[model samples]
Target: MSPRKSVAEALSTRAAILERSVAIASAEGLEGLTIGRLAGELGMSKSGVLGHFGSKETLQLAVLDRAGEIFRAEVWEPARPAAPGLARLRVLCEAWISYLERGVFPGGCFFVAAAHEFDGRPGPVRDAVEARFDAWRGRLRKEAGRAVDAGELPGGTDPDQVAFELLGAVMALNHALQLHHDPRAPELARRTVQARLGRPAAVTGQVHRDPPEPTTAPER
Candidate 1:
């Protein structure tokens, strides 16, 4: 094959590997991603999988990066064009809940799974997860601050506090879906977030929102 073709093929294979790795890590945690396991799943040799990633740590990091990309695409991109302030923030929260409900990851949220897996361990993996979370929460706080400035939320409202409450609702949604398989978890989260932001009751009505489309990603 031409050098360009070889490089293109390599990139394609690597993307496929990372995609499957994200799903596996979401369901089984990053520790479950092994060269041999991926090789078997992808119908490639162990050395082939290792050739792309070099090591388990490198593979884990790549999966984390891929997960971040998926999050931005599914969660952030959809809400980016909404009118800035509480409207944008509400759309962001709804997108997040939809991301989880749609099963973008087999195990719900990749960050949530990886965070619990590496929360106690001191390593590059944990650091990567922490950094992603910090960025996410920071965006939430920034939007909340904008809402306050726009008078959507009370003048006395603390952006950090609102971010915390919204983040808590997401955590609750993850727990409810993963533990009990609750179908209402996402809607419950939506209502909780709307209440926290003080959106009008008529706007938060159940009939107003459509359910998230089911995801094509693999399930556990």
Candidate 2:
């Protein structure tokens, strides 16, 4: 093959490998991804799979990167155009729920599975997962701050606290959907978020204009 053809083919093969790697990691955790298994699944030789990533750790990191791309495209980008403040935050949360509910990954959210799998392990994989989580939480916090500034939320609201609670609700949603097969988990999560943010319950399709009341709700 010509040099151009060779480069094109190599790129195509790499994309295919990464695509399959993401799916496998989502369903089986990053540890379950092996060159032999991937090669067999893709009908390629182990050497072929190894040639692209060189090592299992590198392959896992690549899969994590691919998962992030998928998340941004499917979840973040869809909510990016919404006006800032509560509107944008609400859209972002809805997009996230939709992403999980629609089965973007065969195993639900890739990061959710990976987080549970690698939470105790200390390695580059764990670092990557932690970084993603931190970034996501930071974005949520920033949006919460914006909402506060816009008066959509109470002026004294704690953005980090709000972000924390929202993240917790999402984590619960994932667990309920994956472990208990709860069909109402997403709706419940949406309502939980709406209530947390001082918005009217989503089931009513109404917005509350008053500031959120102080409550002794337990932190999730």
Winning candidate number (TM-score): 1
Cα-based TM-score, every candidate: 0.90, 0.89
List the candidate 2 regions with Cα displacement exceeding 4 Å.
198-220
The TM-score of predicted model 2 comes to: 0.89
Clash number for model 2?
A: 0
Lowest lDDT block of 10, candidate 1: 211-220
The residue-by-residue lDDT of candidate 1 on 1-220, one tens digit each, is 8999999999999999999999899999999999998999999999999999899999999999888878888887776666667877888888889988999889988898888899999999888888888878877888889889988888999999998898889989999999999999988998898789766434532222324432211111
Can you list the residue pairs that collide in candidate 1? Answer: none
| lDDT scores of the candidates, listed in order | 0.83, 0.81
Candidate 2 worst ten-residue window by lDDT: 211-220
